[model samples]
Target: MTPAAIIEPPAMMELHRVWKVYSVGPVKVPALSDVSFQVTKGEFVTLHGPSGAGKTTLLRLLYREEIPSEGEIQVLGLDLARARRGEVAALRRSIGVVFQDARLLPGRTVYENVAFVLRVLGTPRREITARVFEALRAVGLSARAQAYPAQLSQGEAQRAALARAIARKPLLLIADEPTGNLDEGMAAEVLDVIRDVWAGGTTVLVATHQKALARTLRRRTLTLQNGRLLKDEG
Candidate 1:
Protein backbone atom coordinates (compact mmCIF):
# COMPACT_ATOMS: atom_id res chain seq x y z
CA MET A 1 0.00 0.00 0.00
CA THR A 2 1.23 3.56 -0.76
CA PRO A 3 1.78 5.76 2.26
CA ALA A 4 -0.11 8.99 2.75
CA ALA A 5 1.75 12.12 1.70
CA ILE A 6 2.70 14.71 4.26
CA ILE A 7 1.37 18.22 3.71
CA GLU A 8 3.63 21.10 4.50
CA PRO A 9 2.05 24.26 5.78
CA PRO A 10 1.96 27.33 3.58
CA ALA A 11 4.45 30.15 4.07
CA MET A 12 2.74 33.49 4.44
CA MET A 13 4.18 36.99 4.78
CA GLU A 14 1.96 39.82 5.94
CA LEU A 15 2.19 43.53 6.44
CA HIS A 16 -0.61 45.12 8.42
CA ARG A 17 -1.28 48.83 8.19
CA VAL A 18 2.46 49.53 8.17
CA TRP A 19 3.54 53.10 8.48
CA LYS A 20 7.09 54.41 8.36
CA VAL A 21 7.95 57.98 9.20
CA TYR A 22 11.08 59.94 9.92
CA SER A 23 11.42 63.04 12.06
CA VAL A 24 13.79 65.82 11.09
CA GLY A 25 13.99 68.76 13.48
CA PRO A 26 10.29 68.74 14.31
CA VAL A 27 9.34 67.97 10.74
CA LYS A 28 7.88 64.58 9.99
CA VAL A 29 8.71 62.84 6.73
CA PRO A 30 6.54 59.93 5.76
CA ALA A 31 8.04 57.07 3.84
CA LEU A 32 5.12 54.69 3.92
CA SER A 33 1.63 54.94 5.30
CA ASP A 34 -1.10 52.41 5.96
CA VAL A 35 0.40 49.84 3.64
CA SER A 36 -0.98 46.35 3.97
CA PHE A 37 -0.26 43.33 1.81
CA GLN A 38 0.54 39.67 1.86
CA VAL A 39 2.56 37.20 -0.20
CA THR A 40 2.10 33.49 0.10
CA LYS A 41 4.62 30.72 -0.48
CA GLY A 42 6.20 30.53 -3.93
CA GLU A 43 4.69 33.81 -5.13
CA PHE A 44 6.71 36.26 -7.20
CA VAL A 45 5.72 39.89 -6.54
CA THR A 46 6.84 43.30 -7.61
CA LEU A 47 6.54 46.67 -5.88
CA HIS A 48 6.47 49.24 -8.66
CA GLY A 49 6.78 53.01 -8.29
CA PRO A 50 8.79 56.06 -9.16
CA SER A 51 11.69 57.35 -7.08
CA GLY A 52 10.76 58.42 -3.50
CA ALA A 53 7.64 56.32 -3.73
CA GLY A 54 8.59 54.22 -0.68
CA LYS A 55 9.44 51.04 -2.60
CA THR A 56 12.85 50.75 -0.94
CA THR A 57 11.39 51.65 2.42
CA LEU A 58 8.82 48.87 2.09
CA LEU A 59 11.51 46.30 1.23
CA ARG A 60 13.66 47.45 4.14
CA LEU A 61 10.73 46.92 6.47
CA LEU A 62 10.33 43.35 5.26
CA TYR A 63 14.05 42.77 5.78
CA ARG A 64 13.66 44.14 9.33
CA GLU A 65 16.34 46.73 8.75
CA GLU A 66 13.81 49.39 9.72
CA ILE A 67 10.91 49.16 12.09
CA PRO A 68 7.64 50.67 11.10
CA SER A 69 6.49 53.74 12.90
CA GLU A 70 3.07 52.16 13.20
CA GLY A 71 1.39 48.86 12.35
CA GLU A 72 2.92 45.40 12.11
CA ILE A 73 4.96 43.39 9.65
CA GLN A 74 5.28 39.65 9.75
CA VAL A 75 7.28 37.15 7.74
CA LEU A 76 6.64 33.44 8.02
CA GLY A 77 4.79 34.05 11.30
CA LEU A 78 7.51 36.11 12.99
CA ASP A 79 6.47 39.62 13.93
CA LEU A 80 9.13 42.16 13.13
CA ALA A 81 8.05 44.58 15.86
CA ARG A 82 7.80 42.24 18.82
CA ALA A 83 10.53 39.74 17.99
CA ARG A 84 13.61 39.72 20.21
CA ARG A 85 16.95 40.78 18.80
CA GLY A 86 18.17 37.21 18.51
CA GLU A 87 14.84 36.16 17.08
CA VAL A 88 15.10 38.85 14.45
CA ALA A 89 18.59 37.67 13.59
CA ALA A 90 17.34 34.14 13.33
CA LEU A 91 14.54 35.23 11.05
CA ARG A 92 17.03 37.07 8.86
CA ARG A 93 18.94 33.83 8.39
CA SER A 94 16.09 32.53 6.30
CA ILE A 95 15.66 35.77 4.34
CA GLY A 96 17.90 37.23 1.65
CA VAL A 97 18.15 40.80 0.40
CA VAL A 98 19.82 42.12 -2.72
CA PHE A 99 20.31 45.84 -2.45
CA GLN A 100 20.16 48.33 -5.31
CA ASP A 101 23.90 48.77 -5.53
CA ALA A 102 24.83 45.04 -5.40
CA ARG A 103 26.72 46.15 -2.24
CA LEU A 104 29.35 43.43 -2.31
CA LEU A 105 32.28 43.89 0.03
CA PRO A 106 34.84 45.46 -2.28
CA GLY A 107 37.85 43.98 -0.47
CA ARG A 108 36.59 40.41 -0.22
CA THR A 109 36.84 37.73 -2.86
CA VAL A 110 33.58 36.74 -4.49
CA TYR A 111 33.43 33.44 -2.62
CA GLU A 112 34.29 35.09 0.67
CA ASN A 113 31.60 37.73 0.18
CA VAL A 114 29.07 35.05 -0.45
CA ALA A 115 30.30 33.10 2.59
CA PHE A 116 30.29 36.05 4.96
CA VAL A 117 26.69 35.68 6.11
CA LEU A 118 27.17 32.03 6.95
CA ARG A 119 30.29 32.81 8.90
CA VAL A 120 28.45 35.50 10.82
CA LEU A 121 25.82 32.94 11.77
CA GLY A 122 28.61 30.58 12.93
CA THR A 123 28.04 27.96 10.27
CA PRO A 124 30.80 25.37 10.13
CA ARG A 125 33.73 26.15 7.84
CA ARG A 126 33.21 23.04 5.74
CA GLU A 127 29.51 23.77 5.33
CA ILE A 128 30.26 27.36 4.44
CA THR A 129 32.62 26.30 1.68
CA ALA A 130 30.12 23.85 0.27
CA ARG A 131 27.24 26.30 0.36
CA VAL A 132 29.23 29.18 -1.11
CA PHE A 133 30.42 27.08 -4.01
CA GLU A 134 26.92 25.76 -4.59
CA ALA A 135 25.50 29.28 -4.61
CA LEU A 136 28.17 30.51 -7.00
CA ARG A 137 27.45 27.63 -9.33
CA ALA A 138 23.75 28.32 -9.10
CA VAL A 139 24.29 31.92 -10.16
CA GLY A 140 26.80 30.90 -12.86
CA LEU A 141 29.61 32.64 -11.03
CA SER A 142 31.65 29.63 -9.94
CA ALA A 143 34.52 30.37 -12.31
CA ARG A 144 34.98 33.86 -10.83
CA ALA A 145 34.75 32.80 -7.21
CA GLN A 146 38.18 34.19 -6.46
CA ALA A 147 37.64 37.52 -8.20
CA TYR A 148 37.04 40.74 -6.27
CA PRO A 149 34.03 42.98 -6.80
CA ALA A 150 36.30 45.61 -8.29
CA GLN A 151 37.26 43.16 -10.98
CA LEU A 152 33.73 42.31 -11.99
CA SER A 153 31.48 44.17 -14.39
CA GLN A 154 28.19 45.61 -13.11
CA GLY A 155 26.23 42.58 -14.27
CA GLU A 156 28.76 40.11 -12.83
CA ALA A 157 28.79 41.87 -9.49
CA GLN A 158 24.99 41.79 -9.45
CA ARG A 159 25.11 38.05 -10.08
CA ALA A 160 27.55 37.63 -7.21
CA ALA A 161 25.20 39.58 -4.97
CA LEU A 162 22.39 37.24 -5.96
CA ALA A 163 24.61 34.23 -5.23
CA ARG A 164 25.27 35.62 -1.80
CA ALA A 165 21.54 36.13 -1.25
CA ILE A 166 20.69 32.53 -2.24
CA ALA A 167 23.63 30.90 -0.41
CA ARG A 168 21.54 30.51 2.71
CA LYS A 169 18.56 29.07 0.84
CA PRO A 170 16.34 31.84 2.15
CA LEU A 171 12.59 31.29 2.27
CA LEU A 172 11.95 34.81 1.08
CA LEU A 173 14.10 36.93 -1.23
CA ILE A 174 13.85 40.69 -1.59
CA ALA A 175 15.57 42.61 -4.35
CA ASP A 176 15.66 46.42 -4.68
CA GLU A 177 16.32 47.81 -8.12
CA PRO A 178 18.46 44.80 -8.96
CA THR A 179 18.58 45.52 -12.66
CA GLY A 180 18.42 49.30 -12.52
CA ASN A 181 22.00 49.74 -13.61
CA LEU A 182 22.03 47.11 -16.34
CA ASP A 183 21.33 47.29 -20.03
CA GLU A 184 18.20 45.72 -21.50
CA GLY A 185 19.88 42.36 -22.15
CA MET A 186 21.57 42.30 -18.78
CA ALA A 187 18.36 43.29 -17.08
CA ALA A 188 16.61 40.38 -18.75
CA GLU A 189 19.37 38.07 -17.58
CA VAL A 190 19.02 39.29 -14.00
CA LEU A 191 15.26 38.83 -14.08
CA ASP A 192 15.77 35.32 -15.46
CA VAL A 193 17.92 34.45 -12.49
CA ILE A 194 15.28 35.86 -10.14
CA ARG A 195 12.56 33.86 -11.88
CA ASP A 196 14.63 30.71 -11.57
CA VAL A 197 15.12 31.36 -7.87
CA TRP A 198 11.39 31.88 -7.39
CA ALA A 199 10.71 28.66 -9.26
CA GLY A 200 12.70 26.86 -6.59
CA GLY A 201 9.95 27.67 -4.05
CA THR A 202 11.49 30.79 -2.59
CA THR A 203 9.04 33.68 -2.41
CA VAL A 204 10.43 36.73 -4.19
CA LEU A 205 9.61 40.44 -4.12
CA VAL A 206 11.40 42.75 -6.51
CA ALA A 207 11.02 46.51 -6.22
CA THR A 208 11.72 48.44 -9.39
CA HIS A 209 10.80 51.50 -11.41
CA GLN A 210 11.16 49.53 -14.63
CA LYS A 211 7.58 49.08 -15.81
CA ALA A 212 8.58 47.09 -18.87
CA LEU A 213 10.29 44.43 -16.79
CA ALA A 214 7.46 44.30 -14.29
CA ARG A 215 4.89 44.00 -17.08
CA THR A 216 6.96 41.32 -18.75
CA LEU A 217 7.05 39.23 -15.58
CA ARG A 218 3.28 39.75 -15.15
CA ARG A 219 3.50 39.20 -11.43
CA ARG A 220 1.22 40.90 -8.91
CA THR A 221 2.22 44.51 -8.66
CA LEU A 222 1.76 47.03 -5.82
CA THR A 223 2.33 50.67 -6.50
CA LEU A 224 2.94 53.48 -4.04
CA GLN A 225 2.59 57.23 -4.29
CA ASN A 226 3.00 59.92 -1.66
CA GLY A 227 3.67 57.24 0.94
CA ARG A 228 0.35 55.51 0.32
CA LEU A 229 -0.63 52.42 -1.60
CA LEU A 230 -1.99 53.52 -4.94
CA LYS A 231 -2.66 50.28 -6.73
CA ASP A 232 -2.41 46.58 -6.17
CA GLU A 233 -3.21 44.13 -8.96
CA GLY A 234 -2.60 40.47 -8.95
Candidate 2:
Protein backbone atom coordinates (compact mmCIF):
# COMPACT_ATOMS: atom_id res chain seq x y z
CA MET A 1 0.00 0.00 0.00
CA THR A 2 1.31 3.44 -0.88
CA PRO A 3 1.25 5.85 2.03
CA ALA A 4 0.09 9.41 1.48
CA ALA A 5 2.37 12.29 2.46
CA ILE A 6 1.22 14.49 5.33
CA ILE A 7 0.62 18.07 4.37
CA GLU A 8 1.55 20.75 6.86
CA PRO A 9 0.54 24.37 6.62
CA PRO A 10 3.22 27.01 6.10
CA ALA A 11 4.12 28.84 9.33
CA MET A 12 4.93 32.52 9.49
CA MET A 13 5.64 32.51 13.23
CA GLU A 14 5.85 29.92 16.02
CA LEU A 15 6.61 29.99 19.71
CA HIS A 16 6.86 26.94 21.93
CA ARG A 17 6.93 27.09 25.72
CA VAL A 18 8.71 30.46 25.55
CA TRP A 19 9.73 32.29 28.70
CA LYS A 20 11.34 35.67 29.21
CA VAL A 21 12.74 36.97 32.47
CA TYR A 22 14.58 40.20 33.09
CA SER A 23 17.13 40.47 35.85
CA VAL A 24 17.14 43.65 37.83
CA GLY A 25 20.17 43.33 40.08
CA PRO A 26 19.13 40.81 42.73
CA VAL A 27 15.57 40.38 41.49
CA LYS A 28 14.26 38.57 38.45
CA VAL A 29 11.20 39.95 36.72
CA PRO A 30 9.32 37.48 34.56
CA ALA A 31 7.90 39.09 31.48
CA LEU A 32 6.48 35.99 29.83
CA SER A 33 5.89 32.45 31.00
CA ASP A 34 5.37 29.22 29.09
CA VAL A 35 3.80 30.92 26.10
CA SER A 36 3.06 28.74 23.10
CA PHE A 37 1.30 29.51 19.81
CA GLN A 38 1.63 29.34 16.06
CA VAL A 39 0.66 31.75 13.32
CA THR A 40 0.43 30.23 9.88
CA LYS A 41 1.12 32.13 6.68
CA GLY A 42 -1.49 34.66 5.51
CA GLU A 43 -3.41 34.59 8.77
CA PHE A 44 -4.57 37.60 10.75
CA VAL A 45 -4.07 37.09 14.51
CA THR A 46 -4.65 39.34 17.47
CA LEU A 47 -2.96 39.36 20.86
CA HIS A 48 -5.13 40.98 23.50
CA GLY A 49 -4.27 41.77 27.10
CA PRO A 50 -4.22 44.49 29.68
CA SER A 51 -1.15 46.57 30.33
CA GLY A 52 1.74 44.51 31.83
CA ALA A 53 0.27 41.36 30.33
CA GLY A 54 3.34 40.59 28.17
CA LYS A 55 1.83 41.41 24.78
CA THR A 56 4.78 43.64 23.95
CA THR A 57 7.24 40.97 25.10
CA LEU A 58 5.73 38.36 22.85
CA LEU A 59 5.82 40.69 19.83
CA ARG A 60 9.41 41.62 20.63
CA LEU A 61 10.31 37.94 20.59
CA LEU A 62 8.74 37.54 17.14
CA TYR A 63 11.01 40.16 15.53
CA ARG A 64 14.05 39.00 17.53
CA GLU A 65 14.39 42.19 19.51
CA GLU A 66 14.57 39.98 22.62
CA ILE A 67 15.56 36.32 22.84
CA PRO A 68 13.64 33.92 25.00
CA SER A 69 15.05 32.72 28.27
CA GLU A 70 13.77 29.24 27.46
CA GLY A 71 11.93 27.28 24.75
CA GLU A 72 11.97 27.96 21.03
CA ILE A 73 10.74 30.61 18.62
CA GLN A 74 10.84 30.42 14.84
CA VAL A 75 9.92 33.43 12.73
CA LEU A 76 9.88 33.28 8.96
CA GLY A 77 11.60 29.84 9.25
CA LEU A 78 14.62 31.14 11.19
CA ASP A 79 15.22 29.84 14.71
CA LEU A 80 15.33 33.01 16.74
CA ALA A 81 17.19 31.38 19.64
CA ARG A 82 19.96 30.04 17.41
CA ALA A 83 20.00 32.37 14.41
CA ARG A 84 23.13 34.44 13.88
CA ARG A 85 23.08 38.23 14.21
CA GLY A 86 23.13 38.68 10.46
CA GLU A 87 20.35 36.15 10.03
CA VAL A 88 18.21 37.92 12.62
CA ALA A 89 18.84 41.25 10.93
CA ALA A 90 17.80 39.81 7.59
CA LEU A 91 14.66 38.33 9.11
CA ARG A 92 13.73 41.69 10.61
CA ARG A 93 13.95 43.29 7.19
CA SER A 94 11.07 41.06 6.06
CA ILE A 95 8.97 41.96 9.12
CA GLY A 96 7.27 45.30 9.56
CA VAL A 97 6.70 46.69 13.08
CA VAL A 98 4.40 49.46 14.28
CA PHE A 99 4.56 50.92 17.76
CA GLN A 100 2.13 52.98 19.85
CA ASP A 101 3.87 56.16 18.79
CA ALA A 102 4.16 57.03 15.11
CA ARG A 103 7.96 57.27 15.52
CA LEU A 104 8.39 59.20 12.27
CA LEU A 105 11.35 61.50 11.74
CA PRO A 106 10.18 64.91 12.92
CA GLY A 107 12.33 66.92 10.55
CA ARG A 108 11.50 64.86 7.48
CA THR A 109 8.45 64.96 5.24
CA VAL A 110 6.12 61.96 5.30
CA TYR A 111 7.53 60.95 1.91
CA GLU A 112 11.10 61.08 3.21
CA ASN A 113 10.21 59.11 6.34
CA VAL A 114 8.64 56.35 4.30
CA ALA A 115 11.42 56.37 1.69
CA PHE A 116 14.18 56.22 4.29
CA VAL A 117 13.62 52.54 5.12
CA LEU A 118 13.80 51.44 1.49
CA ARG A 119 16.90 53.56 0.93
CA VAL A 120 18.64 51.93 3.89
CA LEU A 121 18.09 48.55 2.20
CA GLY A 122 19.86 49.89 -0.92
CA THR A 123 16.73 50.35 -3.02
CA PRO A 124 17.45 52.56 -6.05
CA ARG A 125 16.26 56.16 -6.03
CA ARG A 126 13.72 55.67 -8.82
CA GLU A 127 12.26 52.61 -7.10
CA ILE A 128 12.19 54.36 -3.75
CA THR A 129 9.79 57.02 -5.02
CA ALA A 130 7.40 54.50 -6.52
CA ARG A 131 7.49 52.17 -3.53
CA VAL A 132 7.03 55.03 -1.09
CA PHE A 133 4.02 56.34 -2.97
CA GLU A 134 2.52 52.89 -3.22
CA ALA A 135 2.80 52.34 0.52
CA LEU A 136 1.50 55.83 1.28
CA ARG A 137 -1.39 55.26 -1.04
CA ALA A 138 -2.21 52.03 0.73
CA VAL A 139 -2.54 53.92 4.02
CA GLY A 140 -4.46 56.77 2.33
CA LEU A 141 -1.65 59.20 3.05
CA SER A 142 -0.41 59.87 -0.48
CA ALA A 143 -1.73 63.42 -0.57
CA ARG A 144 0.20 64.28 2.61
CA ALA A 145 3.51 62.95 1.34
CA GLN A 146 5.26 66.29 1.39
CA ALA A 147 3.91 67.30 4.80
CA TYR A 148 6.20 67.15 7.81
CA PRO A 149 5.31 64.86 10.71
CA ALA A 150 4.49 67.82 12.96
CA GLN A 151 2.03 69.10 10.41
CA LEU A 152 -0.04 65.94 10.50
CA SER A 153 -2.96 65.19 12.80
CA GLN A 154 -2.62 62.26 15.20
CA GLY A 155 -4.43 59.96 12.82
CA GLU A 156 -2.47 61.20 9.83
CA ALA A 157 0.84 60.76 11.63
CA GLN A 158 -0.06 57.22 12.58
CA ARG A 159 -1.07 56.53 9.00
CA ALA A 160 2.24 57.92 7.83
CA ALA A 161 4.02 55.61 10.25
CA LEU A 162 2.05 52.71 8.84
CA ALA A 163 3.06 53.74 5.32
CA ARG A 164 6.69 53.58 6.36
CA ALA A 165 6.31 50.10 7.86
CA ILE A 166 4.61 48.67 4.78
CA ALA A 167 6.98 50.37 2.32
CA ARG A 168 9.11 47.24 2.17
CA LYS A 169 6.08 45.03 1.52
CA PRO A 170 7.15 42.84 4.41
CA LEU A 171 6.09 39.23 4.67
CA LEU A 172 4.72 39.79 8.16
CA LEU A 173 3.37 42.84 9.98
CA ILE A 174 3.32 43.14 13.78
CA ALA A 175 1.76 46.04 15.64
CA ASP A 176 2.06 46.66 19.40
CA GLU A 177 -0.47 48.97 20.99
CA PRO A 178 -0.74 50.74 17.64
CA THR A 179 -3.77 52.79 18.66
CA GLY A 180 -2.89 53.34 22.29
CA ASN A 181 -2.50 57.07 21.95
CA LEU A 182 -5.53 57.73 19.81
CA ASP A 183 -9.18 58.39 20.64
CA GLU A 184 -11.80 55.72 19.93
CA GLY A 185 -12.67 57.10 16.51
CA MET A 186 -9.07 57.62 15.51
CA ALA A 187 -8.21 54.16 16.73
CA ALA A 188 -10.86 52.67 14.48
CA GLU A 189 -9.41 54.57 11.55
CA VAL A 190 -5.94 53.11 12.13
CA LEU A 191 -7.26 49.62 12.65
CA ASP A 192 -9.18 49.82 9.38
CA VAL A 193 -5.94 50.55 7.57
CA ILE A 194 -4.32 47.58 9.26
CA ARG A 195 -7.23 45.40 8.22
CA ASP A 196 -6.81 46.55 4.65
CA VAL A 197 -3.13 45.67 4.74
CA TRP A 198 -3.90 42.21 6.05
CA ALA A 199 -6.52 41.78 3.35
CA GLY A 200 -3.75 42.45 0.85
CA GLY A 201 -2.11 39.17 1.97
CA THR A 202 0.45 40.34 4.49
CA THR A 203 0.41 38.11 7.56
CA VAL A 204 -0.54 40.24 10.55
CA LEU A 205 -0.40 40.08 14.37
CA VAL A 206 -1.83 42.96 16.34
CA ALA A 207 -1.28 43.41 20.09
CA THR A 208 -3.82 45.60 21.82
CA HIS A 209 -5.32 46.12 25.25
CA GLN A 210 -8.73 47.10 23.96
CA LYS A 211 -11.38 44.42 24.07
CA ALA A 212 -13.49 46.41 21.67
CA LEU A 213 -10.68 46.56 19.19
CA ALA A 214 -10.09 42.83 19.41
CA ARG A 215 -13.77 42.19 18.80
CA THR A 216 -13.67 44.52 15.84
CA LEU A 217 -10.77 42.60 14.30
CA ARG A 218 -12.87 39.39 14.41
CA ARG A 219 -9.89 37.12 13.91
CA ARG A 220 -8.21 34.48 16.03
CA THR A 221 -7.62 36.13 19.36
CA LEU A 222 -4.99 35.11 21.91
CA THR A 223 -5.53 36.53 25.35
CA LEU A 224 -2.67 37.08 27.73
CA GLN A 225 -2.88 37.92 31.42
CA ASN A 226 -0.06 38.32 33.88
CA GLY A 227 2.38 36.74 31.42
CA ARG A 228 0.21 33.68 30.81
CA LEU A 229 -1.95 32.81 27.83
CA LEU A 230 -5.48 32.31 29.12
CA LYS A 231 -7.42 31.78 25.95
CA ASP A 232 -7.10 31.34 22.21
CA GLU A 233 -10.44 32.10 20.58
CA GLY A 234 -10.81 31.45 16.91
Tell me, by lDDT, which candidate is best.
2
Off by over 4 Å in 2: none
Candidate 1 colliding pairs, count = 0
TM-scores of the models, in the order given: 0.93, 0.97
lDDT on C-alpha atoms for all candidate structures? 0.89, 0.92
Weakest lDDT window of 10 consecutive positions for candidate 2: 117-126
**Tens digit of per-residue lDDT, candidate 2, span 1-234:** 878988889999889999999899999999999999999999999999999999999999888778899999999899887899889888988999999999999999999998998998777888999999999989888899999998999999999989988999999999998998999888989999999999899999999999888998899999999899999998
RMSD to native for every prediction? 3.7, 1.0
- Candidate 1 lDDT over residue span 1-234, tens digit each: 878998865656898999999899999999998999878888899999899999998888887888999998888899887899889888888898997689999999999999998898778888999999999888888999999999998888999999999999999999999999998887787888999999998999999888897798898998888789999897
Clashing pairs in model 1?
Answer: none
lDDT of 2 at 29: 90
Clashes of each: 0, 0
Identify the leading candidate in terms of TM-score.
Answer: 2
